[model samples]
Target: MSFDTPDDRKYLESHEWATTDEPIRIGISDFAQDELGDVVFVELPDEGDTISHDEPFGVVESIKAVSDLYAPVSGEIVAVNDALHDQPELVNEDPYGDGWLLEIDPSDESEFEELMDADEYEAQIA
Candidate 1:
């Protein structure tokens, strides 16, 4: 199945994606949500919590399994998608939009350069 890997975001090898803009938004990629099947719950870090790059900041539980949601870069959590608490399927229905997990106030802009672009990420998943 084709995944929605938007050109505007950078991705992790493990299938999370993050916006490059300020207060960068972070979420699991379309590919990841599809693979996980229907999401049942999301456990996210509290606002103001600091998360390190490549570290687990939350968990996504699906019918298939529970997976750790990793931070794409070092940042403080500015916001989280509370909508997921009642409607986790948004992760499958609109991962890049309504399903977004966190907004980060990045600690290092340079860290974005270390992430994979859409093409690189597609190739890595291919």
Candidate 2:
């Protein structure tokens, strides 16, 4: 099956995607939500909380399984998508858009260079 892997972001091997823009946006890839089935809950760190790269920062629970959300870059969380509290299916409906999980002020922009590009990520998942 095919998955949406946008060229605008970098992806973790575990399926998280991170944008390079300021206040970097983070979210699971469409492949992740598809694999997870219907998302039922998302547990996220509050705004202002600091997260370390490659560390677990939150959790996403779906009908099929529960998964830990890892940090793609170390930084203070500037925003959290509270809409997911009541509309968890947004993760499935729009994993790259309204389904976004967090935004952070990156401590090291270099970390983005270490992540897989869309082509590499698509190859890995293939």
Candidate 3:
């Protein structure tokens, strides 16, 4: 399946998406979920757990395979979408919105600058 990288969201070559906000919400990209096939399980970090940029934070299990979910910015996890435990397919159906995996109150704002813009990320997957 092909995925369109949204111009509004910054991306990682690892196939995660990020945006700057009070608490950054992170999730697998549409491209990622499409490639992984139907999602079956999602393991996200607990609230208050600290994570570093580009580091593994959790796992996304799809019918095809299991992939590590990475932190786009170093920070403390503030929340996770608990709904995913019952409906993992949300990651495949709506990776950007309701399917979001976690939220982090960042350790440092500068870390978000390291993420790739949509244009650069499009070139990466192309």
Best by TM-score: 2
TM, every model = 0.98, 0.98, 0.95
Give the clash count for each candidate. Answer: 0, 0, 0
- Tens-place lDDT digits, model 1, residues 1-126: 687899999999889999999899999998999999999999998999999999998999999999999889998989989999999999999999999999999998888888999999999878
Local distance difference test, per candidate?
0.93, 0.95, 0.87
Top model by lDDT, which number? 2
Question: Candidate 3's residue-wise lDDT over 56-90, tens digit each?
Answer: 99999988998998888889888989999999999
lDDT of 2 by residue, 32-111 (tens): 99999999999999999999999999999999999999998899999999999999999999999999999999999889
Question: Candidate 1, 117: how far from true, in Å?
Answer: 0.1
Sliding window of 10 residues with minimal summed lDDT for model 3: 1-10
Q: For residue 6, what is the lDDT in candidate 2? A: 99
Give the clashing pairs for model 1.
none
Candidate 3 residue-wise lDDT at 126: 78
Where in model 2 is the C-alpha error above 4 Å?
Answer: none
Which residue runs does candidate 1 get wrong by more than 4 Å? none
Q: Which stretch of 10 consecutive residues in model 1 shows the poorest summed lDDT? A: 1-10
Between 1 and 2, whose TM-score is larger? 2
Reference-based lDDT, residue 113, model 2: 84
